[model samples]
Target chain A: MARVFMKGTEAIAEAAVRTGCRFFAGYPITPQNEIPEYFSRRLPEVGGVFVQGESEVASVSMVYGAASGGTRSMTSSSSPGISLKSEGISYCAAARIPMVYVNVSRGGPGVGSIQPAQMDYLQATKASGNGGFRMRVFAPASVQEAVDMTYKAFDVADQYRRPVLILIDGVVGTMMEPVELPPMKSDEEVAAMKEAKKAWTLTGHKLDYAHRAWIQPGNWSTKVMQSDSEEDAALYKSWQKEAEAEEFMLDDAEVVLTGYGISARIGKSAVKILRAEGIKAGLIRAKTVYPFPYEAYDHINYKKVKGILDIEMSIPALFVEDVQVAVKDRAPISTCLCSGGNIMTREAVLTAARKIMEAK
Target chain B: MELIYSRTKTIQEDKVSGFCPGCMHGTVMKLIGEVIDELGIIEKTACVLGIGCCGLQMDYMAYDNATAPHGRACAVATGLKRTNPDTLVFTYQGDGDLASIGLAETMSAANRGENITVIFINNGIYGMTGGQMAPTTLVGMKASTAPFGRNAKDHGYPMHMCEILNQLTAPAYLVRTSCNNPQNVMKTKNAIKKAFKNQLEGKGFSMVEIVTSCPTNWGLDPLKCLDYIEEKMLPEYPLGVIRDR
Candidate 1:
C-alpha cells in the first residue's frame, strides 16, 4: 500500500508480475536493461518465465509464442532493438496475439546515442510492423504512471488482441521515483484470469467449452462459415467501443493543451503557470495513442475550446498528427516538437498554446 | 514411410514447391514431421524456418511454425525456446541461412546452450531466390552467382558449420549427415530425430546438418543433384558426428 522508490523500468517490471504476467522475453539494451534484469531475478520466484533473448527479433517472437500459449507475455527494448522486433510485432498483429512491448525510447537513426529521445513515437503507434493493426501506446509521465501503465498494458493488449507499448524515454526508464505497486492477485485469481484468457488463446489443448477458431488466407469457404462463436465475436466488438483517451480539466478552458507521457507532466506544470497568468488553458492527456481517444475531443465544450496545443518529445511531430486527427472538425491544434531527447519545457508549451490562442 | 516422424504438418497450406525438384526440403520437412509425431511434441512445439528455400517450410508445416528472414532462424528459435521453455522447439535452416546472414544467431544460440534443436539443411547454394554463392558452397563448385565456381582465394573456403559449432561446449550434439541417397536419408532422419530428442531429454542445444541438394540451383536434374551432393558436398562438408557432449 505504501509507495517505494524504484527506477521507472524496474517499477514496470515489478508491476507486470503483480498484474499476472508470467512470461517475459527481452534483449538487453541501455536505459531499460533494468526491466529485464529485475524480471530475470523476480520471474522465476513466481514460476514465470524470463528469457534474455539472443536478439530483439527472437525476443518479440518469444513473446508472440508465449502470448499465443495463453501466457501473459512481454518484451522491452530501445530504438534499434525495437526496430528489429517490428517483424514479430507484425506477425503478432496478424495473428491477433495479445502481448506488451516496452520501448524505452533512445536517440536513434541507427544505433545513435543512447541518452533519450521521443523519435520512436511514430514507430510505436504507427509502423510497429506491416499491417493496419493499431498498437496501444501508453505515454507515462512519471515513474508512478510508468508502473501503473505496465499493469494496464496487459489488460489492454488482451482486450484488443494486439500489442500494447509503454513508451518511456531514457530519462523515465532510468529515473528513480516513488511508485506504489498494484495489488497482487491471489493464486486463484491469477489462475482464473489465465483460464479466462485461454478462451481466445491457441493453447495446445482445449476444454469442451472452448472451440478453435482457425484463421487462414484464401480460404473462402472458411471465411464464409466464420467459426468464431457469437459470444467471443461480441467480446471482440465491445473492446473496439471502449477505446478512448483520458481528457483532464478542459470543461470551460479556452485553449486545451494536449500531451502524453513526459510531455504531459510538463503540460500540467505549464497549465498551472498559464492559469496563474489568468490564461484559461487546461490539459487533455492522451492515455492511449491508438484508438487515439477521439471521444475526448467530442466531450470538450467546443464553443470555449478555441485551440489545442500538442507538446511532445519527437522529431517528425508524430503524436501531434494523432492529435490533429482526433481534433479534426472539432478544434484547431498546434504543436511544439522536442527532438532527440530535448525535453519540452513548461514555458515552451505554454508559449505555444498562448500563440495558438492569440492567433485564433 | 515416415522419415523423421512429426505428428502434424503446420505448413500444408502452400502447394507450390519453392525448393528445386528432389531438393531435401520436402524430405527434411517430412523428417521433422516424423520427429514431431514420434516425440508427440507437435501440439506444443514451435518451429522456426530460416529464409532461402527452407524458409517457406512453415507454409507446409502444420504446427505453430514461423519464418525468419535469412540466417535468422536460430535467433528466432532462441526466442521461441526461451519464452516457451515448456514446449519443444527447433529451427529449419539451410546453409546460407545458418552460416551466412544468421551465423551470429546460430553460433550464439549454440554457445548459450539454448535448449532447442537446429535442423540445418546444407544445400551448398542459396536455393529460394535461385542459386547464389553460399557460405557452405564447396570450393571449385559452380553456382549461378559464383559463375566461375567458388574460389577459396576470393570467397574463402566453405565453412564447416557443424565442425565450427561443435567447438562450442554448450551444444549437446552436433551431427552432419547427407540426404542425397537413401542410406544418407536414413542417417539424416536419425540425426534429426536424435537432435530433437536431445532437447526432449533436457539436453542443451543440438544441431543436425543434413548435406542436401538444390537441383535447380546446381544446374542439374533431381538425380544429378543427389549425385552431386553424394560425390561433392559430402566429401567437403563431411558426414559424421562432430560433437556429442
Candidate 2:
C-alpha cells in the first residue's frame, strides 16, 4: 500500500481498524479527540462499533467489557482522562483481558494545558493502577512510528492477553506525516478473530470449570485469585525478552541524550547539531517505556561516556528517574527539562549536553 | 407434593452467596436466575457484576460473568453486548455503584440505547463499604456518612433513576420494581424478563431498577428493611413500568 499524508490521530484510528479493532469506545479529550472523531466517521464503513463514551471511566470500562466478549476493543484519552481510566485498565490487567488503549498525553499536573508533555511516562510505565500489573507501553516519536506501533499493538495485546498502550505526547498525536497504512482486515477475518476467542471469551457458550479467562472475581475463589496473580507475575517477568529500544550513534559517544516520544525526536536533532560541531552526542530513544530498555544503557562504553543527559517536557524530570535506574550511577545524570506545556526544544537539549561537559 | 418448579437450572445450588441474611439482594438474584431460565437463555447469557455485595451473585449465577471494578459494570455490559450481540447481556449494580460513581456510564449506555440490560439495585445505603449514604438515599434516611440523617440542604434529594432514565428516549424498557414483597418481587421478575426479551429482540437499552433491601447497612433487621422500603423507599422510587416500548 502507498503511504498517505494523514494526521497522526487519524492514522492511529485507521491503523487500529486495519489491525482488526472492530469496537472503539472513547470520551473526547484534547490532543486525542481526533481519534474518536475519525473513528465515528470511519468505523461505520467497516461494520465496526464506535461509541463516544460519556467519560473516560465509561470508555475504558466499555473497552474492558468489549474485550472480555472477544472483541478487538480500544479506547483513547489524554492525561486527565487516562487517570480516570486507570481503574478499568487495572481491571483488564487483573482479568488478563486483551485490549489496546492510546494515551495522547498533554501537559498535566491537574488539567494543566492541552500542549505536549512527557510527564506521564512514570504513570504509563509504573503506577498504571493500584495493582502492580505492568502494561506494554509504546512511546512512538513520529507519526510513522505511531501508525506502525498502533497497528501492531493489537497483536501484542492478544499475544500477551493484556492491555497495550500507545503513549504518544500531544506533538506526534497532532502532527501530520506520511504513513503506509497496513492492509485492513476483511469482515471474514474479523469474524474468525472472534471465533478464535470462543474458548475464553464471554460468549453464551457452555463453559467448563477450566475456562479461566471468562470467570470474574465474584466467581473466583481465593485460591484461584492467588494462582492467577502468580501466573501473571511470571508472565510479566517473561516480557523482558520482548523489551525494545532504538540506540542511535552510540558506538563511542561520550554524552548520550535519552528521551522518548517527541522529546526523543528533538534529542535526535540535538545530537545531529552536536555531531556537526565535532562533539560526541548520541541518542537513545526509548520505544517501549515499561521495559525501560535498560539493556541499551549497557551497550554504551562506560569508559567513553561522561554522563547521560535526559531531556523531558516535565518539571523536576520524571523520565530521568528511570534513566537513573538504568545507568545505576555508572555516570552522572543531568536533565534539560521544562513543564506546564513547555516543550523540550532541540536547542535546550544541546545546551544541556554542553553544560554536562562544562560541569565535568 | 411433587415440586412444580424447584430452582432455576441456571443458578448454581451449592455456591454460598455473600449477602447478609434477610437482604433482598438474594431475592433480586433469584429473579435474575428465574428470568434467564424461563427465557431458556441460561446457556446463552453473560453478566457484568458491579462492586459491593451485588457482585457475589456471580458465585452462584452459573452463567458466564465479568466482575467489573466499582461503578463500571454497566459500561462493561455495553462492551459485552456489542461484542457478542447474539448472547443476552446484563449488568447487576448497586445504588452506590450505579447511581453515584457510575451515573454517567449508566446514562450513556441507556442514551446510546446499547442493546444491553442493566439490573440496578437501589438500596438506600452503600452495602459494600458499610452504610454510607447513597445518591438514592432518602432525605430523612440515616447513614454512616449522613449521621444526622440526609438533610436536603447538605445532601441532595434522592435521585429516581427510573424517572431520570425514562427521560432518555432511546430506552426500550425502563421500570422501577421491588423485591420488598412477594407481589412486588413477582412484578420485578416480570420486568427483568421483559428487559432480557427486549435485548433478544434487538431492541435498544433496557433497565430494571429493583428497589432492594440492605438490612445490615440500613441499621434495620430483615423485617424492618421491608417496612423501610414499603414506607420510605417505595414512595420515592414507585414500583411499576415507567416505560416499555
TM-score of each: 0.86, 0.95
Model 1 stretches astray by more than 4 angstroms: A187-240, A329-332, A355-360, B1-20, B33-46, B55-64, B68-70, B83-86
The whole-model lDDT of each prediction reads: 0.76, 0.86
Clashes of 2: 0
Name the 10 consecutive residues with the lowest summed lDDT in model 1 chain B. B5-14
Q: In model 2, what lDDT does residue B129 have?
A: 86
TM-score (chain B only), all candidates: 0.92, 0.97
CA-RMSD of model 1:
4.6
What ranges in model 2 sit over 4 Å off?
A207-224, A357-360, B1-3
lDDT of 1 by residue, A214-299 (tens): 31211224544355334335554455555655566678788888877777778888888888888888888876665467677776
Specify the CAPRI tier of model 1: acceptable
lDDT for B148 (candidate 1): 93
User: On residues B18-48, what C-alpha lDDT tens digit does candidate 2 reach at each position?
Assistant: 7799988788877888887778886688888
